[model samples]
Target: MPTAISASVAPQTGAEPRSPGPVSHPAQGKTTEAGGGNPSGIYSAILSRNFPIIGVKEKTFEQLHKKCLEKKVLYLDPEFPPDETSLFYSQKFPIQFVWKRPPEICENPRFIIGGANRTDICQGDLGDCWFLAAIACLTLNERLLFRVIPHDQSFTENYAGIFHFQFWRYGDWVDVVIDDCLPTYNNQLVFTKSNHRNEFWSALLEKAYAKLHGSYEALKGGNTTEAMEDFTGGVTEFFEIKDAPRDMYKIMRKAIERGSLMGCSIDTIVPVQYETRMACGLVRGHAYSVTGLEEALFKGEKVKLVRLRNPWGQVEWNGSWSDGWKDWSFVDKDERARLQHQVTEDGEFWMSYEDFIFHFTKLEICNLTADALESDKLQTWTVSVNEGRWVRGCSAGGCRNFPDTFWTNPQYRLKLLEEDDDPDDSEVICSFLVALMQKNRRKDRKLGANLFTIGFAIYEVPKEMHGNKQHLQKDFFLYNASKARSKTYINMREVSQRFRLPPSEYVIVPSTYEPHQEGEFILRVFSEKRNLSEEAENTISVDRPVPQPGNTNWESEEQQQFRNIFKQIAGDEMEICADELKNVLNTLVKKDQDLKMQGFTLESCRSMIALMDTDGSGRLNLQEFHHLWKKIKAWQKIFKCYDTNHSGTINSYEMRNAVNDAGFHLNSQLYDIITMRYADKHMNIDFDSFICCFVRLEGMFRAFHAFDKDGDGVIKLNVLEWLQLTMYA
Candidate 1:
């Protein structure tokens, strides 16, 4: 299998939060019309590179639900693993395959056990506690659960022994279909299970997700936010408990009120070691879902409380506010009734705010931007996403310490129109989130590439520095660490930093942690206002003259003779290679007086060869060679313009003027770097050095132009291509 490398950069924090416009749903069936030709559509959100807008659509659960009913067959995925070991299940646990609907399994099996409550999910043998925790948190909202697992699905109504579930993969919703076949040991589920034996939603949902990724093994270990995003088409921001925002408590309260799903995990990561119950009653390295947050009066004093669930359906925290702890005794019956307090071994437990913070090390909150409730619909934030890549020899110039070519990588220019409308605040604020994610690492963990350290730099583009400036000046980031507005540089799979910036145009440069490392990335930009659009650089294309057509009447006798000689030496071929061109040059040098006087040597002939081979094939066809011949003639004019003394070389002081005349813009530092690399021992640029410098400049020019797909002289990337990564496959 070919190894794949990819990444995503999403800048999310921005100006004052504003109410977004009404969300639009794509017209069904016509895949091309989804998102309405707008790449920034919210539900159909996928900005991509290379793929067309129509490529994002997939069969909806409703569509597949109807199809399975008509076909009268269970949805047996052709690629489903044949047996247990095929999906890497442990040999000690022999799994017996069973294909049956809910009625056959039990007297009254439910598609959704107990109204999609958190207690309905119970983790079994699988190590996918992170995913189960996400599901538990997702159960908090009935509207949200119905949106994820369509209400139309049930064993009796649409029972063909097939079920379909929808997940937001990258920028679009994808339907995954699976049969009711499950792994059973001793006639019971061997993996994820629910409290009631008749409840099978958790098992079936897990199976659908497993099939979506490749197998159950592929879903073994991962972050909860990844699963939450898939279930809710939400934007997630991860926070470390130690460095959480000052307003974190308020953020958590608002998140729960907004129906956002959250999960937390302890610090330790001991592989394959499962502790049925820790000494503190909180399992280390195990993920727990946050179900509720509230502040209420208890015994004439106000106390903050948080509710959490351990997917195992049994373990409870032994500290204060725990299930049977003494803290509950202090609360009177009325207050207990008001808070809906309960003490049970159903895995759900309450903890004080202080204890919650101290015990959990990391938290993941999925913002649920796409599927926000109708009440919060107007509060949705519009997101603009851009996708990019870092090829080793091309854009992967890496970090800034490599001064020479760091500026050559792709750069995005974002224009912030307005600051947050905070009436009392004197400081202007711009909030945006920057998420840098490595692609395909999760899917091909065993056989494919691993994650790489990645981050991005944001620089302010002064108002005067508008139009035609493709990149920041060489010294723009050199003077101080404060030059770039971003708070700090972090290397992680996906770092979503929310930043505030006064109204200004900013440049974002995404890169690998080290210099010259290659990977592909997607950069997403979100703000309160829709004023954000990439600034396109207008570059002047080189206009080298083409050779006059043959058989023209207005040709001098000498010119006609030379043209005839050129055709005769070239024969049937349209152009010539280096060796063939050398032969032609040799013939011209012997016959032409001007060539003899100029003293052009074989080194010059080789420089010309290096100049014309654009495809790097070391061969030039007719059109390529003609462009080279005309460009060489043009360079001779530039050489004479700078070499006023009529010497064979131009002075070092005059090289910049000569290059600029040839249409290449080099900053002072790049100018110094290039001259040092190519200048002779005498520090003088001979005709050879001059042509070589021009060739290098031309290559840069072409590299920048390659990204301007529509000939609009600007770089635009698709956001969907970056988010999907390997998730789409």
Candidate 2:
């Protein structure tokens, strides 16, 4: 018997749950729950807020699709404004939204003209070759294709301006609803189109997918496997043909037999003279779908063959074994008939297995997973996908290249419970496809960021490690991450790597190429055997019990002097408003020769008062003053911790430690400026100067952190540029 595990684990939690065990939602089709204690390890992030379902309608395809038909209108997500949501899409791209029924667009439009086939698809003006290629592969397997595009409704039956498509998002399969109102320019299709004038299923499917991703611009460019996986809840593995396994042909053949959608691409290099097709008749940098694989007997000898179709519906490879090639004449008349050899202008053509291996640079195979619960005859895979963010000073640790911060990024605990029988190897092993893809980079391209160089590292916990120790430690990754169970450090939008490991617990960390480069990512784990996944829920103990301000023993002599200064400004009332705070600042800057306020406006005084006004009384009492002073004292302690000297001053070198200790991780340029601002005659920062500097520094840090809207360590370049020009100037 195989070990069974649930696909969706509970969301991450802060404290340990009352019952330290898996909470099962059996109706969700999860078979087994994770054995749980306290969430001391990766279980911490099981319930993180990163994942957001579009809505909780929980409707079947019949119910949702019928709802649109009843309304006699196309489906429009009330939550998202059709025109203003995505910058690259509806807004900047200038889409003329029009929802017309099949008959409205064409004199006699059909949902699908004849039966759907690879030849039906044609590339339009959009740069979505990857998606069209996947659609072509879908045509080969009607069962899988119909599964994605439900077969219930047609143009004649439910003639509403609405359509729906299903996609596997992260851990769940979701139905995306969209209106038939597509972007058109002067009554012509702007993006993907079909070869048949009356056909609309291919175009409608593209619109539904665009709506699912927030906009049409989002579907501009992507790898085939992403779309193929969405079309079929299949496990996809990509291979660079040059580095493929020894039994690559055998693997491709077996995959084709088991109903796999495959795609391949030539090296993306096009000569300037050849805009579309090269001299060899193959389109440069274009994706082609692998429609069929065959082993035929030619001239009494066995020969392997591959059938490929270009999404453009023209410009095919004019090589050996191509249409009307000399190789076809070697076949007997009966053999040619058996091979179903029909030569036409359609993009599809047959090529020898050898020629295919030589021409294509990359291959992707998406295996249609079998349902293990329904039948024990086939192997069922357990899949878990989690969404995470790489926030700077928090989770934005880079790859193992930056050892100091790399381990600080998110880590998932993968508990492989069972191993498969391997006849070639002595050890029972489990196979895992660790797939990582960064999200939203394509959407942010107009904003000056592209797909970040991304990858993941997987470390196996030693057999002897027990309990919480099963999580890989930071030091363990310092030198030998290369020794990890699986790690692919590369610069690509998505990367999939396979590994065979003995049944054990392991930690997987996905990160970008450089530290602090921020992006959202989805990490998917597919295992041949059932496995459990959880994230470490790390809670920072920042809110420690506060000491009473009345306790004089806690106050140093300098703190007492500061309190006296406050009392003098407040005139024995021991309370100060924004006006009094301004007066106090003016008096102090006048009295202290070292202090300077270059642009200290009344707004600064009000901002400081707002920061310390815990009770929001528009004023700060003695207790509030003490509370605020203690925070300043905390910053002083951090400065002194790095000072390491009783000289009452520290040099520029120590400022880095002070800033980091204070939890404000500024870049090198900002750190230098802040450090130099407070420097004394010898470029040393005195205790008095440190207090003034950090008080303002705290405000600046809080403001800078606000610009990180996604909580990703990265700030928008335009925003940063605006800040640099306005704030300092």
Q: Which candidate is the best by lDDT?
A: 2
For all predicted structures, in order, the TM-scores are 0.69, 0.69
lDDT of 1: 0.61
Q: TM-score of the candidate numbered 2? A: 0.69
lDDT of 1 by residue, 1-729 (tens): 111122111111000011121211000000000001111222232211122111114544445556767987665445564465335532334445654445666787767644666776777766677778778877766555655565556776767666666676665666666767777655777678878888788888888788776667666655666677677767677676778888888998888767778887665433233333567798765668887787867778888988888777888898977878886778877877766678789888888988988877677777766445535544566576666666543355566756544665567777777777678878987666655555555555446444555667777776788544555544666653422432333333354667777778778877665555656666667676654755223244554346776863525664455456667766777556656776665565356333213444555555566556666666666557656655766776788776667666775545655666787755434555665666665556776567667765665456446656687767654787434321211
What are the lDDT figures for the candidates, one per model? 0.61, 0.62
- Indicate the TM-score of model 1: 0.69
Which 10-residue window of candidate 1 scores lowest in summed lDDT? 25-34
Model 1 residue runs over 4 Å out of place are: 1-68, 81-86, 89-107, 245-247, 269-277, 473-475, 479-493, 535-579, 582-627, 630-729
Q: What's the CA error at residue 714 for candidate 1, in Å?
A: 16
